[model samples]
Target chain A: DTAVSQTPKYLVTQMGNDKSIKCEQNLGHDTMYWYKQDSKKFLKIMFSYNNKELIINETVPNRFSPKSPDKAHLNLHINSLELGDSAVYFCASSQEERKAFFGQGTRLTVV
Target chain B: GESVGLHLPTLSVQEGDNSIINCAYSNSASDYFIWYKQESGKGPQFIIDIRSNMDKRQGQRVTVLLNKTVKHLSLQIAATQPGDSAVYFCAEVTGGGNKLTFGTGTQLKVEL
Candidate 1:
């Protein structure tokens, strides 16, 4: 079974369009996070949720929002995806602040 | 934002030799650290982690060492193989449930 899974491994869209990426984990972790890997392969934290509560929301654009319906799922939605938004988005989880289990990542490409 | 950095952006080692990757972080308050290995076209896989209190931790074929005073971290892999060729990243986590800052990553090329 896929431990942490993300849907649509590749997404191609136009600028000014809205898109969303879905992630789920079966590890029964209490915390989940979203990270962005830029072209230079720099991974940065975007948002995080703990027990379905918003925890860390970095200087991410307000156009991007994260929704966690429960402890096992977290989704990222972008209002207007620009070319600069083209990057690999990863979903990860950790229990009690241990090692973070990450998904394969969703590669979003804005055309 | 806090920054994690790697001393070498690229490293090449022959197979059967050992590999060592180094990282430095600017945040003194950071206590938790992780090393991730990412193969081309794949997500990063957890290699190992070291807490600030611990100086060393070992896994099957890897060892992570941390120096809290200098905010330095290193990962050593024994018997490096061609399959071990990948980009290794070092991440730092503060005392929180989230927020992991990753370095630019070191491209490890294991020569056959």
Candidate 2:
């Protein structure tokens, strides 16, 4: 069974478009996070949630919004996509403050 | 600003040989460290972790060594195989925070 899973392994969209990537975790973890990996393989934190509450929100643009309807799910919605927003997005979860388990990743390309 | 960095960007190793990847961090108050492996087109996978109280930890064929004095960390893999080829990252958590800051990463290529 997959501990953390995100939908749309690949997403290709044009600029000025709006899209959403969904994530779910079955590990019953209290914390979930969204990370972006650039072309150079640099992984940076974008957003974090703990028990359906927002915790960490980095310097990401206001175009990106993350929603957590429940503890098991966190969805990222990007309004007015930009070419620079093209990157691999990963969803992860961890219990307490320990190691995190990541999903395969969603490669979003804003063409 | 706190950051983790790797000495080498890429390391090539022959099969049957051991491999070592090194990382350095700037955060002295960081209490936990972890190593993750990421293959092509995949997310980072947890390899091993070490708490500040421990200097060394082992799992399967991998061993993690942490030196608090120099704020350095290393991962050693025994009998490196072709399947072991991937980008390895070192991450740290400071002051018991849930945020994990990752290093630049090292690409390990195991040659046959």
Candidate 3:
């Protein structure tokens, strides 16, 4: 079974449309994170939530918002998606001070 | 503003050879370090990690070394195989939260 899972492995939409990516972890970890991998393959942390508490928010565009209903679920919603937003999104979770496990990743394509 | 960066952007090696990927961090406060393997169109999978207190840690066929003095980190994979061809990245975490600063990454190509 997948430890961390993401939905819609590939998303293609218009530049001004809205979309969301969902992620879940079955490992029962308290911490969940979202990372964006650019076309250049540089992965950067966007948001991380510890026990449903908002923490580690990068300077991502306000158009992109992350919501964590529970410690096991962290989702990303984008408004007015832009061309620059075309990239891969990954979900990860870890125990306190422990190694993180990642999901299969979702590739978002904004045209 | 400090970030983890890699020395080489890409490397190629014979399938049976060894692979060493280097990373340099700018944050001395970083207390945790990890190495990840990312295949094409896939997420980054954790390979190994080492805390600032230790200099080396090994798992399976991979080894992670942390040189806190130089703010440098490295990952070594023994007997690189064709399945080892992927992008490797080093990550650093300074606090207890889940935030992680990742290196630019080094693409490893294993030639058979």
Colliding residue pairs in candidate 3: none
Off by over 4 Å in 2: none
Residue B107 error, candidate 2, Å: 0.7
Model 3, A1-111: lDDT tens digits are 888999989999999999999999999998898889998888888888889997888899999899999889999999999999999998889886347788898989999
What TM-score does chain A of each model score against the native chain A? 0.97, 0.98, 0.96
- Tens-digit lDDT track of model 1 for B3-99: 8999999999999999999999899877688899999878888888877789999998999999888888999999999999999999887856356
**Candidate 3 wrongly placed segments (more than 4 Å):** none
Task: Pick the lDDT winner.
Answer: 2
Model 3 gets an lDDT of 0.88
Put down candidate 1 lDDT per residue, A1-111, tens digits, no spaces: 999999889999999999999999999999999999999899888988999999889999999999999999999999988899999999999885548888999999999
Candidate 3 residues B13-104, lDDT tens each? Answer: 99889899999998887778989898886788888888889999999999998888898899999999999999999988777635678889
Clashing pairs for model 1 are: none
Q: Pick the candidate with the highest TM-score.
A: 2
Candidate 1 differs from the real structure by a C-alpha RMSD in angstroms, to one decimal, of 1.3
Arranged by lDDT, best first: 2, 1, 3
DockQ of each: 0.67, 0.67, 0.65
Candidate 2: pairs in clash: none
